[model samples]
Target: MTLFEQSGTWRPVDRAAQQVQTLSFEMPEGVTAFRVGLEFDRSGGGVLDLGCDGPHGWVGWSGGERSSVVISEEWSTPGYLPTAVSAAEWHVVVGLHEVPAAGVDYRVVVSRATAADVAAERRAQPAAPPVPERPPGRDLPAVDGMRWLAADFHAHTLHSDGALSIDELAALAVSRGLDVLAVTDHNTTSHHAHLAQVGERYGITLVPGQEVTTDRGHANAFGDIGFVDFRRPGRQWQRDVAERGGILSVNHPLGGDSCWRMELDQPTAVAEIWHSSWHALPVLRNWGGPLAWWLSWGKDTVPIGGSDFHREGSDALPGSPTTWVLCEGQDVLGGVAAGRTAVGVDPQGPVLLRVGDELMALGADGALLSTFEEGRRRIVGDRVVLPAAAGPWWLEDDHRCVLALCL
Candidate 1:
């Protein structure tokens, strides 16, 4: 039964007045499930984000990736969480991401559903891909008991906007030779529940994460910490994530459109200085932008990398710029917290790592090891070791294309 329905035209003026608007409806008593559907004039070149909020607080958000979502006690859509139906006011939160000058008409419908309806509308889980044999582990030296783990700190799945399911994403990460893959869906933690089971099946660690998204910027909250509120200020996100025992990393600070433009009194401890967006242009064109941002951001900032992978042919594949963390076992977050990380062009590409007060450059013969404190030095051999100094070091080719980064 239809409980609430609304239709209106949203314009640029409305968006400027209020970025997010909510349509409220009282959930009927004894309802087994509920569904919210949003329809907007896509032809008008407008973008609308969809989400739900129960009386308790944030339920889920799919950004512009989904138009409709269903919730029940047993099952819910990928971007939403399943919870027991409650008799209270619920809200359909709409974000006017982009509104055309001419305005765009939109409609939102909220309906009650039965168990049978939810079962009929449930999406089937995708089959897991065959596990591929992993390549032999790298022999890079680490302190006494720690080992280097190849990780990709940013990637998405069907839980947000990516093309694959959690199972498929884990398999793909394993196949790409990643030891850890942080599943950071956009503004939601629905994917957190499935990480352990799927990671165990594919023999890789799937760290729970959420991409705290906003029009101003995007940040990644890493670990099993609950959802970080996207509507909050950027500084609040850093505080909340840290309070919840999770680490926040500013993502793709120089990413056009999605860059870090939000103001923060103090910089986040971690930042993704190397992103797959750099691949969209010529190698040498924007290589220095992220480096420049990092230098100005803070001296002790821990630099990381991510592919920001979504679907095939969209962004760089997982592990395209692998983040190697030196940690014990599967403690990828712990490694990140301690600032023990290095990034390479790919899992098997040239890398610069800090080892016991010395800098080791591997697979980087003929490349230049450049650091801010010390001047550039030509790496003559495949494996070269140099006296370590204060660093935000990188290995770049003759064309100045960055191949590896170490913090």
Candidate 2:
């Protein structure tokens, strides 16, 4: 017999990311078995998490790992701990991960059974590996009296969907000659807690980042500042991140299916037009749409690159086309936000930087420069007219291979 059957659509707002919405329902007397479930009806846009807390404390938190869950005295949802369903004001917690400007539409289903034993739900992901000691620092070149720090602004660990541990990722960064790394997990700031200790030991500026992820698009919030909810609108994020002394970037807008579809309400700080995609990125011309998108918002939105390092493979590893930030001290994010940056094809390859009125290609071994619009060819010099490099352009080798791109 049905004990509690209810459903409704929740239209979350800007502050919903840090909120815990609770729907209370009483457990009827003689309830032998209990079950709770949540479902979403949308094509693709944002992300919302699900969990429950009873009179005692947390009962289940499945996140986006599972759609619905069954909870009773015997078992519960995957990634959740089952407990006795006491008769009290039980609470259903909706963990808002992403809520679009149009809001989200959802439903909840809670019911009971006469007699049944719940099956063992899928277990939580293995506990994240213990943080390891910091590795020795690596060497990198200094440019224009300022350090050309090799950094990766987009990466992940087990705190999200990555396979490596925090320490493991750090070790790999060192191998890849990265001077700085940003741990941008899917949607949670839980990884930030371990950054200080681990980053100090690893000798790299481990900038705490959160990938404000949803089906419609994804972005990276860079800094060690406090958590920012992913459920708010994109405009809210740009404003909130800046107010908190952090920077924001639209990530991999040209990625298939995951390409950014969100409208730009404000002029953001950065754009990840060059990601680790073999078919699309700084090394390819498949970024016209996204480049035009950023260009439409004006030059305030600086173009940047990220390896999008999740795990080490041949597709792309950490710091493949390194982002060279010209900064004093350790102001990596500051350099990116200010557009004082350049991207190289590899860690030790040539880089294209805009110095004063000239677009300079340093250490390029005499590579050719060309515009994406095919307007002109700069086949003879390390410096091109600042006018020619205004829009989107690329540096290439003798074989016509794209080395680095700037938008």
Candidate 3:
């Protein structure tokens, strides 16, 4: 049965009034399940984000990825959390992400779900794919009991705008030979509940993360810390994450529309200086842009890399430009917090790492090593070690294209 329905035209004036608008409805008694559907003029060149809030608090948000969501006591949509139905006031929140000058018409419908409907929806869910055979692990060396792990600090699943589910994404990461993957869906922690179970099944570590997204900038809050509110300022994100025993990293500071433009009193400890987008151009040119930004922002900021993998063909695959973290065990976040990270073109690509009191250059024969203190030195062999100096070092090919980076 139809519970509530609303239709209206959203103009630029409406968006100017408020980016996010909420409509509320009182739930009738004895309704065990509900579904919310949002429809808008697709060809009108407008973007609308959908989410829900129960009397308790935030339930879920799918940005502009999903148009409809179902919730009940037994199951919920991939991006939503399941909650028991009760007679109370609930809200549908709409974000006017992009509104055309001419305005766009939209409609939102909330309906009651019967048991048969819920059962059929559950039956239609996809099954997990067969696990793929992962490649052999690298034999990179480290100090005493520490080891270097291959990781990618940014990725997504269907919990947000990503194409794959949590299980499918984990399988893909394992197949690409990544030891760790951070699932950073935009503005939501709905995926965190399944990370551990899926990671164990795929034999990979999945770090809990949420991309605190806004029109001005985006940052990744790493750890199992609860949701970092996206509606807050960027500085508050840093403080909130830190106070909760987590770390925050500025993501893709130079990314076109998604760049870091928000003002902050201080910069985060880590920055994604090497992103998969750099692979599209001459490596040195792309690397230099972010390097200059980082130098100006904060020279001491630790550098990291991410593919920002969302779908198969959209972004580079996970582990393309792998992040190598040196840690005692499966503590990728700990390694990142300690500034023990390096980036390579891929899982098996040339790499420069700081081992003990020296530098280790693997698979980087004939490349030039650029460092902060020691200007430049030519690497003669694939496995070459030299006396360490002030770092933020990288290996560049004769064409001036960067092959690897170390922090």
- lDDT at 353, model 2: 66
Comparison by lDDT, 1 against 2, better one: 1
Q: What is the per-residue lDDT of model 2 for residues 1-407, given as tens digits with 9 covering 90 to 100?
A: 55555565556554354445777888877664576777776555757676667777656455655566666665554334456777787877776666666777777777774333363332443443343443343243455677667888788776565767777788777667788888987666657767778777767788889888765689898887655555567777777888899988888886777787887566566888667773334456333454466566665567777888767664578876678787888888877876777666667666776655566665565677766455435545443344443645667766666677664
Off by over 4 Å in 3: 281-287, 372-374
User: Each candidate's lDDT (Cα)?
Assistant: 0.88, 0.68, 0.87
Best by lDDT: 1
Give me the runs in candidate 1 sitting further than 4 Å from their true place: 283-286
Candidate 2, lDDT over the whole model: 0.68
Which residue pairs does candidate 1 place in steric collision?
none
Looking at model 3, which ten-residue stretch has the lowest summed lDDT? 280-289
Any idea how many clashes model 2 has?
3
TM-score of 3: 0.95
Better of 2 and 3 by lDDT: 3
Query: What is candidate 3's lDDT per residue for 1-407, written digit by digit as tens?
Result: 89999999999999998888898999999999999999999797999999888887778889999898888878888777777888999999898999999998999999999888788877876678888999999889966789999999999998889999889999999999999999999888889999999999999999999888887888989999987878778878888998999989989888888899888768888888788888765543435776677678776677788899999977899998899999889988899998889899899999899886789999999999985554678999989999876567888877667789886
